[model samples]
Target: MTREARQEALERHGLVESGDGFTVTLKGFQKAAERARGLRAQGNQEAALMLALEPSDPVRWEYARCLQIDTFSTEAYESGF
Candidate 1:
């Protein structure tokens, strides 16, 4: 997806972009988790898992938690949870 689309997704998922624009949101975290899962599902398990395991802001803590619970043994939980 385009950067705009990604930004919109983050907003839709309840993430607000900081004034500096570098901060990560709950939505962005969730999107990353989703991207990871999608990559895994497409047989790119390494990439998918990597995406999910990246660090995010506290705002995304909840989103990461959810992804962790869902993915369980995956590295997504390591970064997100």
Candidate 2:
């Protein structure tokens, strides 16, 4: 993605570009980056990026389900049963 698109994606996902160089504070963004890195290592860069960019993806919601208790309720609703 272009720099503008990446910045927009970060904002859309509620990430703030704070902290020292290359560091991100948002837990969700950290998790997404980890997941994306793993996917990219496995040669699935497109899928990795999609997971990072698309907050509406069921996979993203599911991933969040494992990360935070508060996410469960919202993810359930977002998943549409």
Candidate 3:
């Protein structure tokens, strides 16, 4: 999808743009994260984990790490830290 289409979907899904210009909404974030995981499950590992990330989240770095590990493993591993 185009950036504009993604933005429209986000808006239609009730994600609001914060002052910082990033989308912010718990429901939307969760949905995006879930979508990301589904992408992984469907063998779209890169797209899946990319969708799971929120730049402002403190856990973003960890999520990236998880993505790397997830790429190599058949089973998902939880971050211990």
Candidate 4:
């Protein structure tokens, strides 16, 4: 997906972009996911599933994927003939 789409996903999950314009706070997402996992381990299936289905996970994935790509120099990549 495009950067805009990925950013939109992050925004939908309440993750605001940092000053660098390419990063987002991940502590909250991590904590929530951890909590959900704990709940699942404790047999709270309903709550666990509810948390698991939240949009934060998708946003996290998108953010991670973005980080893995070399997006700093689009022009260089495009001109690499």
Sliding window of 10 residues with minimal summed lDDT for model 2: 64-73
By lDDT, rank the candidates, best first.
1, 2, 3, 4
**Which pairs clash in model 3?**
none
Candidate 4 lDDT, 1-81, residue by residue in tens: 467766555554435556765443464355445555676789986545555565656754453334323232333246451
Q: What's the lDDT for residue 47 in model 4?
A: 43
lDDT of 1 by residue, 14-49 (tens): 455568533444554656577667767889856455
Q: What are the per-residue Cα lDDT tens digits for candidate 2 across 1-81?
A: 556755554454434454632223356555655656676789885646556556766666545433333333344346553
Worst 10 residues of 3 by lDDT: 72-81
RMSD of each: 12.0, 14.2, 13.1, 11.1
- Candidate 1, superposed: residue stretches over 4 Å from native: 1-10, 13-15, 51-81
Q: Return whichever of 1 and 3 wins on lDDT.
A: 1
- What value of lDDT does candidate 3 attain over all alpha carbons? 0.50
lDDT of each: 0.51, 0.51, 0.50, 0.49
Q: Across residues 7-76, which tens digit of lDDT does each residue of candidate 3 receive?
A: 5654544355557544435555455466567777889967554655565655653454343334323221
- Each model's TM-score, in the order given? 0.36, 0.30, 0.39, 0.31
Candidate 4 residue pairs in clash (backbone atoms < 3 Å):
none
Give the Cα-based TM-score of candidate 1 against the true structure. 0.36
- Give candidate 2 regions above 4 Å deviation: 1-25, 47-81
Winner of 1 and 4 under lDDT: 1
Show how many residue pairs clash in every candidate, following the order shown. 0, 0, 0, 0
